[model samples]
Target chain A: MTAIGKVSLRDTVFQRGRSKERSKLLVFNHTVLLLLTAFAVIPLAVLLFNSLKTELDIGQNPLGPPRTIVIENFREAWEEGDFAITMRNSVIYVVATITAELVLGGLAAYALARKRPPGSDLLMLYFLVASTIPVWMYIVPLFVQMRMMKMLGTFHGLIIIYIAGNAPLTIFLLRSYMIDLPSELEDAARVDGANEFQVLTRIVLPLTKPGFLTVGLVVGLGVWNEYTLALTFIHDPNRFPVTTSFAKFVDRFDTNWALTSAGAIIILFPVMVLFLALQRQFIEGLAEGGIKT
Target chain B: MAVLTQQKPTTVIEKLSDEIWRKKFLRNVIIPWVFIAPLLIIHIFVVAIPAVQGVYMSMTDWGGINPNVNFIGLDNYHELLFEDKSFGKSLNNNIVWMLFFLTVPFILALFCASMLAQIKRGGMLYRSILFIPYVLASVVTTTIWKNLLNPKDGIVAASARALGIEGFEVAFLGRTDTALMSIAFIDNWHFWGFLMILFLAAMQAIPPVLYDAAKIDGANRWQEFRHVTLPGIRPIVLFMFMMVAIWSFLAFDYIWLITQGGPGGASEVIATQLYKNAFQRFEAGYAAAQGVVISIFAGFIIMIFVMLRRRGWDI
Candidate 1:
């Protein structure tokens, strides 16, 4: 009886010790995570704070809370910097490029996924090779072509260039997703007397909405943020995209930190909202398409 | 008898003709062509034309603005390779940038991913916060860092002063020696978050049973990590490594905005050099040649990646 009681007592002590160790570990983990979170959040918070303060306040008390939030910085930035035009240009460019990329990219992807055409595999390989090629090499030549065609400084030209540059990867990603779709569904559509066009539009397109959304979001973000091509091709200020316009703002020696930061924040808001709204689909798409190759 | 035979023969020929008409050629070929034509036109006009033009431009002596250009065979390539001192410096900087940027972030990300994988609570929050920097425009990122790293009245300098390091200010971005490293550090800051999330996702996809088995075999944390986590994430690590290598070679925005290839061209990467030659100097031909060199280097690295990929590193 005494031996049995002693054994139980020992077991209880050991269990307590293990529980204490586990709690310690949990605390340690939480502390580390909090620290990391602070590190990540601090710089952005500082930027926001600076954006709200006048430049003098920023120079004086960099880390301190703003004495008075200057709400007029955004208004000033919009008017003086012509950010409204820049924003419009960004929207137009992103929308046009994404639409063309999706339609064209989707068609190519469907062909590769469904048709199994002769040399389709070779075409796919060519795309992979093309996607990895350094785009800077093509920039000068593209510039020359745009000049020759009298398309430089035109929105239509920018759209064409953006679509062409982005189509290879977009097609690659869309194709992968389309290929994963079950063949049985397509076969059933054919059995129902649906021709290839009907199958593509009615059946495949509906099912691949997620893939389209993913491609659209990624490509849109890239086109919106692109600077080099825009800077090179769009010599006219009126035709400048948001990125090139922002770069011009920098070059003008305009050190209005509040306005600059406000503009940055404003530019980022849409992308942030889009990401938050479609976080799941965006992440899944990136995981599947980006990591696969 | 003759009328009955002629009517039967005509009916047979009409039936065969109807069957042939049903195999619609337009449906098979034209429809798909209609769908594909837009992308094909854009690709041929924008991408292919320019790419070919870039090659031709390399062999000529063309100032970008001038309509007239002299065909000077191999002169631009010869100058870039032999005469240009800055080109060599840019090449060296690119190499260093690739090494530091690829290895440091990769290791840090792996560690962070492993730790995050062990935790269950607040995982999504951690991931979102980490990925915030990557979504910011490069211009914004560079602007913020420029202020942060300023020699006078910058937050970092002020903090150092507060910590009793009197007059301990470093013009990191302005100095030739430290400029490249500073730019690299900023690049890592903006990038590490995205990589961490990627690695975390990869880590989470690894099965828990592997760790359970390792523990059952009397393995400790380090041993379990080696036996389970390392092997599980090897492919992801290799893939990310190659991506970092490629991206580092292509690094431009931060270097361009922050340094502008300044402090005696210490931070002049290949991309920036290419830009300067093409745009600022109006040496379109020379820039094209430099571009070809850049492509060759990029192609070499890509080939290595492809070979490794083909060897079943990942499919």
Candidate 2:
């Protein structure tokens, strides 16, 4: 009985020591994460702070919180940066690109995942190879082609390119998602006299809604944040998306810290909101899509 | 009339079977292609054809818009190889960018991701916060950093002055010496979190049993990471290394947005130089050559990794 008591006492001591070490490790991890969090967040906070500060206030306190909030920067930036038109254009591009990309990519993904037509493997291989081809490899010729086709400087033209650029990613992601789903339900729908298209619509679409959502969010964010293509294709100032337009705005108003800061915030606002709300989807989808693309 | 009527029944059976065969063929074969056609066609039109044409374009002296075009085979490549000083500088800068990304982000991300992987509580918050910068547009990210790094009245200057750090208030983005590295730093600030998140996800996917086994074997924290965590996440780590390496050559948006390869071409990467050549200088053929060179570099890197994988490196 005395030996048993001693062993139990020793066990408690070891357990306590282990717990202490674990907590120490946890504390260290938290500290590093906190510092990194500050590293990641502080610059953005500075931008936000500067956006709220007046010009004179920003000069005095560039990185600190504002002494007095100023609302004029937003108004000034909105007008001078042409946020009204550019943001609207970006919205149209994001929505249209996501819509078309989903429809086309979903159909293609469904076929690739389920139907597996003649030469489907070859088609898949083509996309896999094509997806790896960088935009730099083709941009110059694509520009010429766009010009020849009279698609340059047009919204639909840019949107079409966006859809095409995102197609491989959408197809791959949605195909992976669809492949996991049970084929039994689709078979049942087919047996119930549903044609292929009807089966896709009534059965497959409902089941694969999450996949679509993820693809849509990923593709839409890409379109919203796209820079190179928009800069190359859309030269018309009125047709410029928020990215290229904001780039030009910053160039013209480089010294106007408050105005530029506010413009930056405005451009980031929608994305920030969507990300905060659907962060799981955004993070997972982007992580997957980014790796593949 | 009686013999023709008897043959009609057999003909009906043959036609019915033929119809069934046709319907089965349509459902099984043609329909899927129909489904795949639209996006595939768009992709071909936008990417595949242009990519093919770019190779031929590289051999020509088509000055973007001029009706007169002539094939000057290999001249563009020859100039890029021997004569073009700017191209040399840009290619060298791309190498620098690649090396920086290959080292700094990998170390930072691997360390932080392993640290985060150890913590269960508040890991999500840290991840989401860290990833916020990645979600922002390149324009916004560059703007935020540019303002913060502004030599005059920017935070860095202000803080340097407050700390009495003399000569630390120089315009990082405006100077030739510091421009490329500085832009890389800014790009990294917006990028490393993404790598961290990727690493973190990979780390989380690693089996807990291997970690347990390492612990049972009396592995120290570093040993545990080295033996268990590292190998477990090797595939993702190696894949991302290749990707980051490829993307380094294609690095354009951040550099273009911030410096436009400026302060006297100190940060002139191939992509930015190619952009200027194609759009501004209207040397479309030369730009096409540059583009082809960039793609070849990317492809070569991919090939090396693939070759290693095929040779059973397990990477």
Candidate 3:
């Protein structure tokens, strides 16, 4: 009893000493993390602050908080940047690309998973090689080819490109998701005389709603933020999506910090809202899709 | 298909015959291909055919405009390698970039991830905040930083003036010496946080008992981390290393957005070079060669990792 009490007392004493050391480490750890968090966040705060500042204020105080909020900058930016047309354009691209990509990719993923179609391995091999081919490798010929087909500088052209570009990723993610589903329900549906398409839509699709959602979100976000393809194929400003249009706007308004800042904020608002609402999925999906720029 | 399958008799012989038909030409071949054809056709037209055309075009003197393209085998590759000093410089810059990305983000992420992993409370807040930059578009990120780094009316000069620090108001993205590094720094700001979140996730997956055992062994935090945490996350760390290395070659958008590989070709990477060649300079053949070179580097990295795996490395 005496020995056990002695050991307990020693452990408590050691823990007490460790607490002092740990307290110091905790401060150090948090200070470093706090600094990094600021590094990531402060510039964004500055953009928001500058967006509300006048040119006079921005010229005088580059990154300081606004003395008075200038919500008019958003209005000004909206008009001048042509964000009305551009945002609508971006929505079209996002909606069409996501819908087409999900439908096509979902069907392919379904075939790869359930159907185990003949030559599935060959298809997998093709995508594995295709995914590794840099866009630069194909951009020139693709441009020439698009022009040949009269698909360049058109919305359908851009949408077709986006749908194809996104297929490999969508197939890879959704196929893995579909593969894990139990075969019993599918077997029962088949036994009950469900056709292949019916089995897919009724039993498989509903069961894999989360998979579809993930593919939709990933493809939607990619199409929305896409720059290089849009920059290349959609040369007409009338058809410019928000990103390419915003880039041009920022360049033209180089000195108009308030306007450009407002533009940046407007471009990011939808993404921010969606991200906060779906933080987990966004993080996980991006982590998995880290190969993308 | 299912209707035909459903009409089968219960006899094993009948069921066997039906299963054979279903597994063969009907179920396995025709029906599956019907479902797969749409996506396959799209991919073939958009990616495969163009890619094959690109390879063939790379060996020619195609200026991207004229219908006449002359085949000149190995000339584009020869010129890119021997005559293009800018290619070498850009290649050097890419190397510097790969080095920067492979180290800076890894360190920052490891440090921040380790620190965040220690704190249970408010960890989510810090992570979410750190990850915000990653979610922002490249245009927005570049725009935000360009203004911040602008010489006369930017945060750098303004803050320096506020603090009475003189002679630090140089143009970061304008000067040749600073341009590539500046773009890299901006890209890292948007990138490291994502790395932090990823590393933190891997760290979280590490068994707590490992830490407990390390503590019982009188191992300090550094020792514990070096011995346990590093090994625990080796696969993810190495995988990210390979990914960052591959991505460094393809680094574009930010550099293109900010500088367009200019202010005297200071920040020209392969992709930017390829873009300018195809669109601006109309050197389609040369640009295709550059693309092939970039892919070769990326493929080489993949090959190394694959070979390492073949050699029984856990990664």
Best by TM-score: 2
Chain B TM-score of every predicted model:
0.90, 0.95, 0.92
TM-score of each: 0.91, 0.96, 0.93
Model 2, A1-293: lDDT tens digits are 12323332443466576766776777898999999999899999999999999999987778889999998999999999999999999999999999999999999999999998889889888988888899999999999999999999999899989988999899999999899989999899888899999988898899899999999999999899999999999999999999999999999998889999999999999999999999999999989988888
RMSD of 3: 4.8
User: Candidate 3 residues B1-315, lDDT tens each?
Assistant: 668856947899988887787667776678888888999999999999998888888999999998889999999999999999889988998999999999999999998888888775687788888899988889999999999899896878778978999986989999999999999999999889888888888888877767767878999889988998889888889999998998899999999999999889899888988898889999899888888888889999999999999999998
DockQ of each: 0.34, 0.51, 0.48
Ranking by DockQ: 2, 3, 1
Candidate number of the best DockQ? 2
Task: Indicate which candidate wins on lDDT.
Answer: 2
Error of 1 at A87 (Å): 0.5
Instruction: Give every collision pair in model 2.
Output: none
Clashing pairs in 3: none
Location of the lowest summed lDDT over 10 successive residues in candidate 1 chain B: B1-10
Q: Candidate 2: what's its TM-score on chain B?
A: 0.95
Decreasing TM-score order of the candidates: 2, 3, 1
Q: What i-RMS does each candidate reach, in Å?
A: 8.0, 6.7, 6.3
Question: What TM-score applies to chain A of candidate 1?
Answer: 0.88
Which candidate do you rate higher for TM-score, 1 or 2?
A: 2
lDDT by residue (A76-158, candidate 1, tens digit) is 76776678888898899999998889888999888877675556777777667667767777888877778888998999998
lDDT for each residue of candidate 2 in B1-315, tens digit (9 for 90 to 100)? 354335443587887876686688799888988999999999999999999999999999998998888999999999999999999999999999999999998999999998888765677889899999889899999999899888877778888999988887889999999999999999899889888888888888777767666766888889989998899899989999999999999999999999899989999999999999999999999999999999999999999999999999988
Residue ranges of candidate 2 with Cα displaced over 4 Å: A1-14, B1-10
